[model samples]
Target chain A: MFRYLVRRFLQMIMVFFATTFIVYALMYWTGGDPIQALAGEKPVNDVLRAQLTKEYGLDQPFLVRYWNYITDLLHGDLGNTLVGRPIKDVLADAWPITIQLAVIAIVVTILFGVTAGVIAGIRRGSIFDNTTLVLTLIVIGIPSVVLAPLAQYLFTIQWKIFPTTAGGDASLWDLLLPGIVLGSLSVATAMRLTRASVSENLRADFVRTARSKGMPGRRVIGIHVLRNSLIPIVTFLGVELGSLMAGAIVTEGVFNIPGVGYQLSKALTTEDTPLIIGIVSVLVVIFLVANLIVDLLYAVLDPRIRYE
Target chain B: MTDIHVSSPPTVGGGRHLLEVKDLFVEFHTRDGVARVINGVSYHLDPGETLAVLGESGSGKSVTAQAIMGILDMPPAKIPSGQILYKGENLLAMPEEKRRQVRGKEISMIFQDALSALNPVFPVGWQISETLRTRAGMSKKDALNRAVELMDLVKIPAARARIRDYPHQFSGGMRQRVMIAMALAMDPKVLIADEPTTALDVTVQAQIMDLLGDLRRDLNMGLILITHDLGVVADVADRIAVMYAGRIVEHADVRNVYKHPAHPYTEGLLDSIPRLDSKGTELATIKGLPPNLMRPPTGCAFHPRCKYAKAVCTTETPLSLDLGHGRTSACHFAKEMLDGTLR
Candidate 1:
């Protein structure tokens, strides 16, 4: 198991480098002149451009520039934005809000999605099953872009139940609307996956054996059916966590929340290459770590799946 | 056949059957319509006896066992009317809670596919101990200890070492043994083994049958062995019930049924067995498929498949005729068939 962990850690390092390199390359290829962006509408003289390029080390070759970025990253320097603000400070300010939103969104997704799925699966062919199926399909069909604003309008603008926008001082209650909106698609996906997996497990021979063993219906469904069904759900939730980070980008914009996604969006508009790389690199690391954790969770959920 | 050693008859406690099924009828509500899977099937089992239910696929043998175990799914499978009597109490009339208490404690079942029947995620020991923990209220430690003991009882070698292995880690034969160990953990009075050895090779089949026979004798439990293998029935079964299309066509002592089959279906089954003495001969096969339960024939469900089916067989359903010496055959010409005069 220790060997497995060590191996995963090595792989995570490789993925981290590969991800940062690709993002850095994409930004370099697509971005406008950082010096021009810094100068705004004021025309830049040749000496000023050269000086700006030299200061940022953008005058160096791509490989040299990347090597410098890696060395700086090793020393905990995340470079600076076009405005000369440290990318680290920007991320530090933004990360807490995104993490809060993502965590709450994930919790809601799992609680509501898994419960609805299990109930629907066990009571298959009943009205509850049919209704849940229809509702999930409807939720899945609507993209989050449309759903987010609609939810914002209903709960915040119209109902006046929640704040119109989540700011730094907003309470958990203020974040609830945006969190649900951010997790809406994931909830639908999780519910569908869970329902299908649970229904399939209900037909498993082991479930019949459990029933024959004098286990009560409730215990049988809980211990035998639900436990077995959780493997796929866990895997889905891991992938969903990664997407949730990406999803928060639009949701934060929609709700006017000053999270990492909101900062990343603004950075993208301004072609803030350093800030873009920082955010994407962080998201990539988070995604990889979530996947690694999911893999580890498999061992906990299923005894047959041993790491060694 | 000469190597076959029949165990001594079970000590029957004068008219007190351990388990009895009376006119049990099971139906399935499918898209086609209501399909009567088990049609008025009845049998009695006594402690320490092995009753082998022999039949082709879809003859309601497994369904009968499932119905008796109260494990049949309700919506698709509906027991219209029946009585599963255990210790003279109607199990069908008992509340579901009470019935559950009887399951895995007083009555247990071993399914055909052990790999699928055992939970893939849990260790074999955990699966075995789960019953002990839940039904008997044994502490985790005690239940695990009992699980090892039960595994040893089923003759799984190195029981202590292999107890932590999952179902997939074991071979087909070993998994069946694990399943048997789980069933026997509760010390049930009646154990229903549905095609217990069907998934095993011939050699392993014999070994499993021997293990079951030895366990039955040792525990004095009423064993209902569900299989279509006549060879297996000959080796261990005390009595055999031959079913055709959801109805028992013959029920008699194993020896008697082999010597002179009163039902045509039984005759066909016996003749179909390939023997060492009859090499290079075309194996006799019972012709035609088992009738679909959705729309069974009007009179006798087996008439289309029975070689000796007569004109009366087409229009009249034959009731079970009692032959002397605790034998019964559901055939109009059972007497002539028994007398060897039907031909």
Candidate 2:
């Protein structure tokens, strides 16, 4: 297990470097001059451009510039945005909101989704199963972009139940609407995956054996069926965690919540290369860690699964 | 063969049978229609007696056992009318809670495929101990200790060391032993082993059968061995009940049935076994497929596959005829077959 962890950590480092390099290369090769974007209304001149290029290491070769970025990144320096604000400061201000939204959304998605799925799977073909299936389908079919605004309109503009947009002093109640909108698709996906898994486990011979062992129906479903079905659902949730961070971009926009995703969109408009790279690197690290945790959980959920 | 008869003495406990099935009928509601899977299946099991319910696939041997165990899915499977009497109490008439108490405590089952039968995610010991914990209300520590003891009972070597191993880690034979251990954990009065050795090797098959026979004798439990292999049950089974298309065609002492099969299906099954003495000869096989239960033939389900099937066999369903000494055959020409008057 230690060897497995070491290997995974090494793989994570490799992925981190690869992703950062790709983001850097894409930003550079895309032909948008960060210095010019920063200059705004200022007239272009050789001295100013040269000073800006030298300061950011854009004057150096791609490898050298990337090496400098990596070295600075190791020392906890995320450089600066085109607007001359420190990327680290920007992230420090935005990350907590995104984390809060993602955590709440993920928790709600898993809790409600798995409960509904287990019920539907145990009583397969029943009215409850049919209803959940149809509801999840409808939720999954509507993209978050459409669903988010619709939810914002319903909960805020029309119902007046929630504020139109969250403020700096936003509480859990303020985060609920945006979190639900962001988690809607994931809830549907988790429900369907869990339903399919639980239904399949229900048909497994072990379940029949459990029943024949005189296990009560509730224990049989809970301990045997649900435990077995959780493997796939956990895996899905891990991947969904990464997608949820990405999905928060549109969700944040609709709710006007100041999160990492909101900052990412703002950076994209201004071509803030450093801010974009900082946010992307953080998201990549989060995604990789989630995947690693999921890998560890596999061994816990199933004894037959072992890592050497 | 003489030892086979001698090993199974007449029910030593007098008329107090462990289990008795009376006119048990099971049907499945499928898209086609209601499939009559088990039609009037009846048998009685005595303590320390091994009754092998032998038949081809789809002959309702497993289904009948499932029905008795109360494990069949009710929506698809329905017991229209029947009595599964355990200790003289009709299980069918009892509430689900009462039936559940009898299931693992008084009567337990070992399924065919042990790999699938045992939960893949859990240790074999945990699976065994789960029954002890839930049904017997044993503490976790006590149940685990009992699990190791049961493992030793099934002859799994190094029980303490291997108790933590998952089902997939055990070989087919070892896994089947694990399943047997699990069933025996509750010390049930009746153990229904459904093709327990079917997934095992030839040598392992003999070993499992030997283990089951010894365990049954030691525990004095009524063992219902369900199998399609005629040769496997011949030595271990005290009595053999041969079924064809959901109906028992012959029920007699194992030795008697082997010596003179009163039903053609039973004869065909015996003949199909490749004998070492008859090397280089083509193995005899039954001609046709087992009839579909959805629309079984009007008269006898086996008539189409029986070589000696007469016009009466095709038009009239034969009731079980008593031959002396509790031997019964559901064939019109059972006397003729027994007397060697019919080919």
Candidate 3:
């Protein structure tokens, strides 16, 4: 098992580098003139432009610039934004909000989504099952872009039940609505995946064995059926956690919550290359790490799966 | 339902057998139609006796076992009418809670395909110990120790070490041993083994049958061995019930059935078994497939496939005729068949 983890760790590192490079390359190839954006519509003097370009290493070739970025990354320097704010400080200010949002979103997904899924699966073809099926399809169909603002309008503005926007001092309470909106799609996916898995495992031969053992119906479903069903659900949640940590731009925008996605969007408008790369690099690592954890969790849930 | 089949002479006090399935009728409500699976099936088992239920695929042998275990999914698979009696009490009429108490504790079951029957996630020891922990209220350590003992009882090699392994880690025969150990955990009065050796190789099949037979004799438990293998049934089973299309075509002592099958279906099954004495000849096979349950043929369900099917056979269902010496055959010409005068 230790050897397997070590191999997985090495693979994670390789994937991390490969992912960060691709993100960097994509940004570099598609980016507009960052120097011009910094100059703010004024025609820059040749000398000033040259000095600014040399300072930021914009004059260097793509490979040289990429190498320098990697070197600085190894030395614990994330460089600075176009406005000279340390990218590290910017991330430090933004990541906690996104992490809190993602954690709450995942908890909500598990508590509500998995419960509904298990019920729907066990009582298949019931009214609850039909309702869940339609509701999940509806939620999955509506993109977050439309759902976020509409939810904000319905719950915050019209109903006046939730806060309209997150204040500067955003408590977890203020972020709750946005969290649900951010997790809505994943909630649908988790519910459907869990429902399918639970229903499938419900008829499995082991379940009959468990029942034959005089196990209570509750434990048969809770332990035997649910344990086997959790493998796929956990895999989906692990990958979802990484994306959730990256934050939902629409959800953050609608709620006016300052988070990683909000900062990333602002950087996009200003062509803040360093900030973009810094945030994306962290996200790449998170995604790889989450995948590694899921793989490890797979072995825990299913003894039949062995890794050498 | 046959009166003679259900009215077996009681024990000294007029009490029932250890386990009795009386006139059970099971039907499956499917998209196509209601598929009649078990039609007035009746049998009884006594302590320390092994009753082998012999049938081809789709003959409702496994379904009958599942119905007794209370594991058949309702709605899709429903028991229209039946009495599964344990100690003279109707299990079908019992409350779910009381019935559950009987399951695993009083009447446990082992299934075919041991690898699939055992939970894939738990260790084999834990699976065996689970009933002990839950029903008997044994401590974790005590349950585990007893699990090792049970494994040893079933003749699993290195029981102490192999107990911690999962079901998939064991060979097919070894896995079946693990299943047997689990079923025997609570010292159940009635142990239903549904095709216990069907998934095993030929040599392993004999070994498993032997282990089961020995265990039944040692524990003084009633063993219901469900299988299609007549060869496996010959030695281990005291009595055998041969099923055809969801009904018992013949019920008799194993020796009697082997010597002179009263039902043509049982005769065909015996003939189909490959024998060294009949080498290089085309193996005898029963003609036609088992009838589709959703739309069973008229009269005797096996008439379409019976070699001696006649005009009356296609028009009238045979009664379960009581032959002398504790044998019953549901055939119009059962007497002639037993006397070797059918031809």
Each prediction's TM-score versus the true structure? 0.95, 0.96, 0.96
Computed on C-alphas against the true complex, the DockQ of each candidate is: 0.75, 0.82, 0.88
State the lDDT of candidate 1 residue by residue for B202-297, as single tens digits.
899999999999999999999999998898989889999998888899999999999999999999999999999999989999899999889899
Worst 10 residues of 3 chain B by lDDT: B1-10
Q: Which ten residues in a row have the lowest lDDT in candidate 1 chain B?
A: B1-10
**TM accuracy, model 1:** 0.95
**What digit string (tens of lDDT, one per residue) describes model 2 on residues A1-308?**
99999999999999999999999889779938888888876788999889888887787998888888889998989888877788888888887888789888998898888788888887889999999999998998898788988998888999999888986656889998888788777888888888899999999999989998989899998899888999999888887876676538888988888888899998898788888887888888888988888889888988888899
2 versus 3: better lDDT goes to: 3
Decoy 3 TM-score against native: 0.96
Q: Model 2, B191-271: lDDT tens per residue? A: 999999888899999999999999999999999999999999989999999998889999999999889999888899999
Task: Sort all candidates by lDDT, best to worst.
Answer: 3, 2, 1
How would you class the docking of model 1?
A: medium
Best-matching candidate per TM-score: 3
Sliding window of 10 residues with minimal summed lDDT for model 3 chain A: A32-41
Fraction of native Cα-Cα interface contacts (under 8 Å, chains A and B) also present in model 3? 0.93
Whole-model lDDT, candidate 2? 0.88
- In candidate 3, stretches whose alpha carbon ends up further than 4 angstroms from where it belongs are B1-15
- Root-mean-square deviation (CA) per prediction: 4.9, 4.5, 3.3
Candidate 3 Cα lDDT to native: 0.90
Per-residue alpha-carbon lDDT of model 3 for A159-262, expressed as tens digits? 99889998556899999999988877888988888899999999999999999999999999999999899989988888899889888887887898889999
Question: Model 2, chain B: what is the TM-score?
Answer: 0.95
Q: For model 1, how does the per-residue alpha-carbon lDDT over A100-120 read when each residue is reduced to its tens digit? A: 788889998998998888888
